[model samples]
Target: MSIEIEMETTTMKIYDTEGFPNPARVRIALAEKGATNDVDFVAVDVMGGEHRTDAFKAKNPDAVVPCLELADGSHISQCTAITEYIDGHFEGPSLTGETPKERAQVSMMNLRAENGLLNAVGAYFHHATPGLGPDLETYQCAEWGNKQREVAGQTMSYLNEVLADNAYLAGNKFSMADITAFAGLAFADFAKVEIPQSLSNLNAWRAKVAARPSIAG
Candidate 1:
């Protein structure tokens, strides 16, 4: 199903670090909208503290990657907002949702995947593990991180239960929720969080989402 009209275009740019989970979310969203080629990808020196510099902070106060720069010089940060922009600006299947109820569902599931899986794994990585080394990881909280690791495991089981009834995280239709959950699982693997082998439905769903052209290629 086609979405919004392709607007009067310009060289939109995305500042990100390739291969990172959050960046991958925006990248997949672009591919889904068929606007991957249209946007200019500007690499960020995240490891060297480029993302923390004053100029970068001006663009994104949060100092995170995958920030979108519009033709009018406005900036949009966070994967959710960026994906929403991409979904509405380009013509393709709706990523957010086609209706209000569906939109709410997508948003709800996306948050669960993000907080329970993605960010949970991230906390463990940056806190419990030697994430970016001492230069970047200025703070350490092994206890909190270890607790979040448990949260991640519990969330995976909950997701498995949800998947037992629905083909996707939100429902039958693929939406932003699926994308968030997919990226979350990738982060989980990177963080060395054990994915329960018994979660057959989640594993099956992961394989299916991984096969999509936006991800497979």
Candidate 2:
């Protein structure tokens, strides 16, 4: 479906790190939208605490990657919000659904991917493990992190079941939900949480999504 949306007047700068799932999600959305050339990509040294510094904090209070800096000096943080703006501003494939119902369904599935899988993996990674460093991971909770690993695994199975009928996470077409789910799976891999090989449907779906040029590094 063709969407008629206004272009963003502001110059776009993407602050991100290489190989990070959240940053990769934004890159995938940009690739899908064919808007990669439209913005200046800046690599932030996440491991060097570049994102945690006061200078970076002024740009993004959350101190997280994949933050979009607009020409008006406003910042858009979080993967979903950035993708939504990019989808509406650029002329290309729509990552979020086009219509109201489509948008609602896509947003629903995207949240499911976030809370059920992505956040679970993130909790496990930060709480259960050493994370970035001692200075950063001051409140590590091994027990809570370990529990989230199991939660992530369970969510993966649930996702597998959902994908059994649908071609993508939200519906037949590729959307933000799929990008979020893919990022979640990548996070799981980093967290050492394995998806069961017995879930053939999910395995096939993973392979299919992996083949997409948008996800290709």
Candidate 3:
């Protein structure tokens, strides 16, 4: 006999952007956990200052990308929070982890990648490039931006070294940590930051992750 599993459908409103990293991370996570169709996509134009508007700030005071507005009028900011919620509530594969030890490892790796690698890249972009052409003067700290780029490059090298033997950043399975790293790395490319060819393991792993339908979606 075959057993069928039923999953409750949940509708979510996602405030996102097409080429942004933070939003893409949440989008990719939703795809990995098969929660894409459950969400209503709302594109917030970051370049147009939509996120900085009062209306957007009411939903998220931080005015950050990838805000999740629930049907209950509750809002959740931060890509990690949204992904974690989906991983916990969704009925498919758990991206966070199954066991206590596994969860800890996954969280640890994910945090490291976000803080050390992703944040560095963000700093590089905000301070160096500042795609906000007219608002470029808002970030003229070229010295700081250059420093951040170097830091991010170093962090990528470190991550590549650590991921040499591991199939994924957290451990053997493809968890949220890998997703975070991939989003960060992808964003870095747009920022004109190049990942060293020496990071062959990371490149290989990225290729594997990129092949996922969710990523393509």
lDDT on C-alpha atoms for all candidate structures: 0.94, 0.90, 0.86
lDDT of 2 by residue, 1-217 (tens): 9999998676689999978989988999999988888889999998878998999999999999989999998999999999999999999878899889999989999998898899989999999988877877879889998998888888889889989999998888999999999999989888888889998888899899999988764
True-vs-predicted CA distance for residue 118, candidate 3, Å: 1.6
Candidate 3 clashes between residue pairs 3 or more apart in a chain or in different chains: none
lDDT, candidate 3, 10-114, per-residue tens: 578999887788888888888887878888999998878889899999999998888998878899998888898989877888899899999999999999889
C-alpha RMSD of candidate 1: 5.9
Ranking by TM-score: 1, 2, 3
Off by over 4 Å in 3: 1-10
Q: What is the lDDT of candidate 3?
A: 0.86
Deviation in Å, model 1, residue 105 alpha carbon: 0.3
Model 2 pairs whose backbones collide: none
Model 1, TM vs. native:
0.95
